[model samples]
Target: MPAEPPVDPMTDRELRADARRNREQVLATAQRLFAAQGLGIPLDEIARRAGVGPGTVHRHFPTKQALYLAVAIDQIRRLVDEGEALAATDDPAALFTLLSRMMASGAENAAVKSALTAAEFDLRDAAPDAAAGLTHQVARLLDRARQAGVVRDDVTVDEVMAIVAGAFAAIRHAGADTSPERSAHLARIILDGLRPPSRR
Candidate 1:
């Protein structure tokens, strides 16, 4: 009999699909657990919640810090995607709309807040590539709004980001008594201040 080609237990496509699913499951599980229990939660617990073995989790992320950084990187990447999408819009008010949406969502995003405030993970150093992309997208969006006369002509991207960071910080520190409506109202107030003198 002609020698049969070595039979692979799993095809390349199947292996890739399995890896993809495992990665997604790990991320989702980690995000949920971290948000509920804080970033101090262990990797094995995340693996348990993800229904994957500890080895599997390590195979994907290698370390808890790696997983945490991955989560933060993913969040930053998503913000960049959103910023890019809004930058493509013709609406003069799209920039503030994006800010409003971010503020609203920030109220519920504990994992991101933790990542931002964490001393252990310096996101700027750890994910410089992703951070720079996000910064560029945000600057592009602000420029679009400025050129449309929606935002102040003198407002720079760094200044705008500083304001946004403060606003998100406020939202993070706000008591449970503070409603989402109140958060939106506060965000709108900031947005109002960002508008051109003529628009105010």
Candidate 2:
């Protein structure tokens, strides 16, 4: 029998890289679709928009619930990244920048979040590491802000979380999920409450 050709290590690495790219594209497309049209969008449609085969999406996310959770987790992980980047800065008010991003990110992915909530899924349970990392980042920033007297010393990381949750609720209650301007306005009002009282 003729000897089989040896597999190229570079080829395997290239294939893996291509798969990663495809997965990222699918995730981004599904996130945009779910945000714009809700979770009713078909997996096939997401693959189509992502320029990948249907099997690609199915291989990565077997069902709508899986996709929803992945999207939610991805959103949080990105926020954690942003928070980490902000923490490296000298700006004490970087806390506001990170919190602002968290608010905006949650609002943008509200539809996916609603679906996960309906399914009784919490990111803290589904993705413990990323969830805890996000909280830790927030805590670090909060501590720095407090030390700088930019934010109220009385506020704990837990309270900051509750306030963000409340802000999201308020935004949804006002039917402002589709309106970035309105959502931002509401978020500002709630975040403003975090500022320390004037010494004057």
Candidate 3:
């Protein structure tokens, strides 16, 4: 893989914090490596670049697929974080904001998503709690949007999720990976349907 920035060196810390920090470094490193070089990058290489012991990576992720799933789960967790932040805001269009963030995040990691699919690792199955939390956040914002007459009243959380999935597919179909501008445009076009007819 091409040389990227090295993971920050582990600092003097307690064991628990050290372990958490190390695992985070590994995930962040693995996510980047997989994104840059695909899933074929070696675990040892990931550990080397992450500035952690090889055993650390293997202990947390015994298989490449495990690491890939972890990366996907990490992405969802970040989205959930964004969703939570939006939930705290009084913005009436927060739902759209959250959805746009989700779409962009998905576009950014479309390669890992493809690898997960090839490995038959569905994130909902692999990390149900994280998946449910994100959906819950989306549903909360969506209810607020509907009440504010921003989103259509008929759309359910399931439909919202389906739309996200469809956005990923459309993004992939257009080969927008290298073009963030094109990806955002596609996301806007798809997510616009969630708005009430007049708003759209």
Candidate 3: deviation at residue 178, Å? Answer: 2.1
In terms of lDDT, model 2 sits at 0.83
Top-lDDT structure, candidate number: 2
Which is the winner by lDDT between candidate 2 and candidate 3?
2
Ranking by TM-score: 2, 3, 1
Deviation in Å, model 1, residue 156 alpha carbon: 0.5
Lowest-lDDT window of 10 residues in candidate 3? 110-119
Give the Cα RMSD of candidate 3.
8.7
Estimated TM-score for each candidate: 0.83, 0.90, 0.86
Residue-level lDDT tens digits of model 3 in 14-131: 6679788899999999888876777789999999999988999999999887887888888888888999999999998999898888877767774334422333565667787887
Give one digit per residue, the lDDT tens place, for model 2 in 104-178. 777888533442233347766788897789889999999999999999889999889777767777888999888
Candidate 1 deviant stretches above 4 angstroms: 1-6, 114-120, 176-179
Candidate 2: residue 44 Cα off by (Å): 1.0
What are the lDDT scores of the predictions, listed in order? Answer: 0.75, 0.83, 0.82
State the lDDT of candidate 1 residue by residue for 1-200, as single tens digits.
Answer: 99999999999999999999999999988877766676789999999999999999999899887897787677767777887788777776777876676555455555455444444566678877876776687688787888888888898877876676677766546653147777777778777889877888
Mark the regions of model 3 whose C-alpha exceeds 4 Å error after superposition.
1-13, 111-119
Which model is ahead, 1 or 2, in terms of lDDT? 2
